[model samples]
Target: MSQSIIAKRYADALFQLGKERSKLDQFETELLTLREVYRDNNKIVSFLKHPRVSVDQKKKVMTDSFQSFSEEIVNTLKLLVERHREDIIADMIQHYIGMMNDAKGIADADVYSVRELSEAEKQRLSETFAPKVGKQSLNLTNIVDSSILGGIRLRVGNRIFDGSVSGKLRRIERELVSTNKR
Candidate 1:
């Protein structure tokens, strides 16, 4: 099976468990913490994938490091270790977080502007664009991009709403060139 399929299965199972136990948000937080740790530490990956390491040793390491996480998460980590699928932990967390966000009618968005956006600007953008995208709200990640020149560019999924000054200028230039050619 593809790694993504395997990751999705695990994510779906965890999502169901979280939903049934009324701990979806808590599980999301735990998964995020684990994902962040794994991303920041290459040594952990090497340790998990080491040929000389016993499964018990791997499980013990995970348990020791993530003792603060819920039993469900810890158990999942142990299972991954046993199955030698620890590499997919980050993918599983991303899928689980996506499921949680979908359940809550939220979409993750990337907003690029020349400068950091204030809370009010974020709120305004969320309010204006969320309904258009059929989401209740947007979880925006602000990116400072000087290339936009002015205004903002919003991306949700595969769609982009480019209202930046550079974008407008490009559109006008395209129109002018096409008209002249005709």
Candidate 2:
């Protein structure tokens, strides 16, 4: 199976477990932390994936590194090591987070602007766009991209609402060119 499909399966199972246990937030947090740890430490991931390293040793390392995490989280890490699927940890965590966000009617958005958006601006954008996207609110991550020139571009999932000056100029140019050609 594709790695993403496998990861989604694991994420679904974990999500179901989280829901049943009423620990959705806790599980997502733990998994995100684990994902960050592996992401930031290439050596640890390489060590775990080494052919010579035993599963027990890898599990021990995981236990030591994540000792404070809940048993369910630790066991899931050990399970991934045992199955030689440790590489999917990050994907699984992402899918789990998506699931959590969907459950809460929240959408994660990337908003690109020429300058940093103030809290009030962000809140206004969230309120204005969230309803359009059928989401309760947007968890906005602001990115300053000077290329936008002015205005902002908002991306929620695969949809983009490009209100940037550069984007408008491009659209107008396209329209004018098409009309002239006709």
Candidate 3:
């Protein structure tokens, strides 16, 4: 099977387990932390993938590194190590988080603006855009992008809602160019 398919299967199983244990939120948090660690430390993944390293040592390292995490997550990591599937760890975590977010009616969004958005502004944006995307709310991540010049540009999944001044200008320019060509 493909890597993404395998990862999704593992994620689905974990999601079911989390639901059964009433720990979806906790598992999501732990998975996010694990993803961060994997992203910031390439050595850990390399160490786990190294041919010279034994499976026992890799499992021990994972357990020791995440001793405080829930048993489900730790065991999952150990299982991945044993199966020589360390490369799919990040993808599995991402899939798990996506599943959790879907279950919670939440969508992750990136809002680009000239400056950092205030909490109230973020909340307002979430309130306004969430319903449009068929979500209860948005987990907004504000990205300060001066290139947008003014207003905000919202991105959710594959859609981009461009309300920025730069975007408007671009649209106008495209229209003018097309008209002139005609």
Candidate 4:
């Protein structure tokens, strides 16, 4: 199945469970931890993705490997592995977090820059995002795009803030054309 459909189901189910249990915040942190676990362990990911391995074996490993987490996470993950939807596990967790964020009125921002910014620069950017967006805080994703030449561009949902040098140049050219036409 496509990532969208998978994400929707996984996200919705997790969201509902979190709400019911009042462990939504815990689930958020644990989900991040799980995503990291999957990302860092290529062997584990490959093992899960391999068609030859039965889902039974997968569940047993999960129960053994991550014995530290809550029973809720453990059981939920078991269900995922059992259903053979482990491939989209990371995305599903993320989509669920996103949905929860939206329900809480949180804004997600995508920041694009020609070069990676330092930690201080990131903090400053968040401070700037607040007044500009009229939001108390933002959930920002940093993206590096060297092709931008220089500067930063940000997108929050439907709104886009273009400050990249290449973007500015394009806008300037468009303005010049419109002015000449006028």
Residues 1-182, candidate 3: write the lDDT tens digits: 99999999999999999899999989999999999999999899889989999999999999999999999999999999999999999999989989888988999999999999999999999999999999999999999999999999999999999999999999999999999998
Q: After superposition, how far is residue 89 of candidate 3 from its true place, in Å?
A: 0.9
Global lDDT of model 2: 0.93
The TM-scores of all predictions, comma-separated, are: 0.95, 0.94, 0.90, 0.81
Candidate 4: list runs displaced more than 4 Å.
Answer: 1-3, 114-120, 131-134, 142-151
After superposition, candidate 3 runs with Cα above 4 Å error: none
Candidate 4 per-residue C-alpha lDDT over 1-182 given as tens digits, one digit per residue, 9 for 90 to 100: 68779868877887888899998888888888988988888999899889999989999999998788778888888888998878788888779788777776677888999877887887788778856877666777889999889999999888888989999999999999999999
Pick by lDDT: 2 or 4, better one:
2
Error of 4 at 94 (Å): 1.2
Candidate 2 residue lDDT tens string, 1-182:
99999999999989898888988889988887887887788999899889999999999999998999988888888999999998888898999999988988899999999999999999999999999999999999999999999999999999999999999999999999999999
Tell me which of candidates 3 and 4 scores higher on TM-score: 3
Alpha-carbon runs more than 4 Å astray in model 1: none
Tens-place lDDT per residue, model 1, 44-92, is: 9999999999999999999999999999999999999999998888889
Q: How far is 176's C-alpha from truth in model 1 (Å)?
A: 1.0
Model 1 lDDT on a 0 to 1 scale: 0.95
- Clash count list over all predictions: 0, 0, 0, 0
What clash pairs does model 3 have? none
In order, the Cα lDDT scores of the candidates are 0.95, 0.93, 0.95, 0.84
- The TM-score, computed over Cα atoms with residue i paired to residue i, of candidate 2 is 0.94
